[model samples]
Target: MLSNFLPFLYGISVFVLLILAAKIMLNGFVSSQASLKTQNSFSKKKKDDRTGLVTVHPELLNKDGCITDEDLLTVRFAKDSDHPQSSENPSE
Candidate 1:
């Protein structure tokens, strides 16, 4: 039984190593691709000549259009009836 298990164990260990190497290679490729994408996105933004200013437009705001997190905190949440409870368990 011991002799029979040795070859199977060796094969499984080799397979596991191969899988780990593949995962590392795939992760490196993905990381490099993501970095390149980020670089391309930044490069595409047209540089402002007036003051050499780089500005990012805010995605969320009120009617006044103040670009700040403090502006968002000013808004009030509704009563207990407005808050809905989920039926599904999040931990699972």
Candidate 2:
């Protein structure tokens, strides 16, 4: 009697696992579609040259929404040295 019931138990467990897998796949697909829907709606509401994500600061843009010619600021960091700057053992 026990041997005869084992096959049925295995079939039920396999069916349950299959159902769980299907639910996981469906959830992923639905969440992805929802994200796409939100992104599309956001772009449709904005409708601008800037695609994807746009910065909140638009002060640099001109009347045509293009950046005007301007000087770029550059930053330079001091190079690291293993020996002290005042070291007298400088190798010639």
Candidate 3:
């Protein structure tokens, strides 16, 4: 009786492994296809010269949607300031 159950258990284990492998492969293929589609679409489209994903999130845009001098200075300093905290004390 134990010998007869061996083949059935083996077959079930193989089937389950195959199912898991297929699921993983299908998920990978779907994600890759989606990424490819996005890349192709982005490549084909013309991006605005003045605006981008990085630019949009910045604090430069004013209430009127214009770049002011304060905004420009703030952005440049905030992003590229190497030494943010000064070694000198203000009370000194």
lDDT (10s digit) by residue, model 3, range 1-92:
99999999999999999999999999999999999999888878866543554456447667888764561332335578585554447785
* Candidate 3 ranges with C-alpha deviation above 4 Å: 46-92
Error in Å for residue 10 of model 3: 0.4
Q: TM-scores for all candidates?
A: 0.46, 0.48, 0.48
Compared with the true structure, model 2 gives a TM-score of 0.48
Give the Cα RMSD of candidate 1: 15.5
lDDT of 1: 0.74
Give one digit per residue, the lDDT tens place, for model 1 in 5-79: 999999999999999999999999999999999878777875454458755466655457865454232334675
Clashing residue pairs found in predicted model 3: none
- Best candidate, lDDT-wise? 2
Model 1 quality (TM-score): 0.46
Reference-based TM-score, model 3: 0.48
Q: Is candidate 1 or candidate 2 better by TM-score?
A: 2
- Give the count of colliding residue pairs in each prediction: 0, 0, 0
Root-mean-square deviation (CA) per prediction: 15.5, 14.2, 8.2
Please give the lDDT score at residue 70 for candidate 1: 49
